[model samples]
Target: MHMKFIGLLLAATLLLRCQPSSSVDPITTGPEPEPYRIVRDSIKTGTYLGIAIDEQAASVYPKIQALQATKGVSALNVVSNVFADLIALKERLPLYQYILLDQKSGTDSGVQITVEGKTVKSIYLNSGQQLTQWPEKQAVDSSVRVGDAISTLYDKLVAIRNIDRYTNKFEYISLMTKNLSADYDGGMSQSPQWYFGFSTGPNQMDQIQVHFRGGKVSKLYIDHYSKY
Candidate 1:
């Protein structure tokens, strides 16, 4: 009887230790957790836009870094930023069509988040008075992944940047379009090769060219940036 009781005690102790910290314990069993799910149908769209005030604007990057630094968002302060109030950021998975805000209008700038996957397809800054437009509707095809789509888009955007008013040797610069064109006013610069912003400016020399691979862009060789 003593041996049997000792064996039972050890088994019970092991089982108790294995008991999950949370009652819901979706990770161990039960329905999927709020913030974690396997998105089916292949394509889902989610956009998070935030506008920051003066000091807050610069804090945006730091906030993101801090939140990530914690390894996990166990604490709230590590999660909240002037631009984003990620209070309930957890307990919820990436859903389609969502907007998060700290305070709409401010002195500094706002942020836009459009990610098909881990890859950022679009990012924008909101200047005061300027309206941030979230497309009411967007088309998402079954691309292998967001990275592939961005690679495709980057290639196309680069090609578009190649054609310049200056001497053309066919060079291109790869860029983060959403960030660079956040203001949308756009600009152009030249030295080794020409670079153009949003609105296609008049070419000083060769006709600007944009290469496309089907609906998605493939490869680009801008004259200035593209060593290609």
Candidate 2:
């Protein structure tokens, strides 16, 4: 009976050893959280133009106090020395543009002005998109060339999407001229525009559209499946 009991105990131990283990490998879970998703909440809040008046721009174009004299506008958006002459012919200019919305009257009005070295070169009142208010057409120079503009746009995207670390997650699809015309203004015009396209994946379902005009970003659009 003692031998039989010992044999039974040995058989039980073997059975236990043969049973499959429940422990799982720690590496089986999917890759670490995507870094871009960290800023997902901010991205969903509103449209991000990624426009900021930098130190150089601010130094060249100081804030205008007269804008507050207007009925509703209490402040102005001052952007200085944002663009440079490709030929290095002239100093960079500052841009004064502000938007004012009156909730009581449901009225909206704004002003856009371009200042060249302390002199107002152009002014547009109540203009939308500010396309019509772009400074007098100048030849596209190497200083603020298309390539430079593209780089700036890319940097802005990296900041806005918070994907600077995961830049590999995006693929630059193409940079094509949307409105390539030398006669844009009846003569050689500087307002040439291009559309830059980028996709988050090879599927090309999600895309980022960057519209560049006059060597500066004019508009930004994000096309994602979630939006639809």
TM-score of each: 0.18, 0.17
Error of 2 at 97 (Å): 36
Output the worst ten-in-a-row residue range by lDDT, candidate 2.
19-28
lDDT of 1: 0.22
Candidate 1 backbone clash number: 15
**Regions of candidate 1 where Cα sits further than 4 Å from its true position:** 1-85, 97-104, 128-228
Give lDDT for model 2: 0.23
Residues 83-152 of candidate 2 have per-residue lDDT tens digits of 2112221111111111111122221122223232223333332222333322225223311121223223
How many steric overlaps are in each model, in order?
15, 4
Which one is best on lDDT? 2
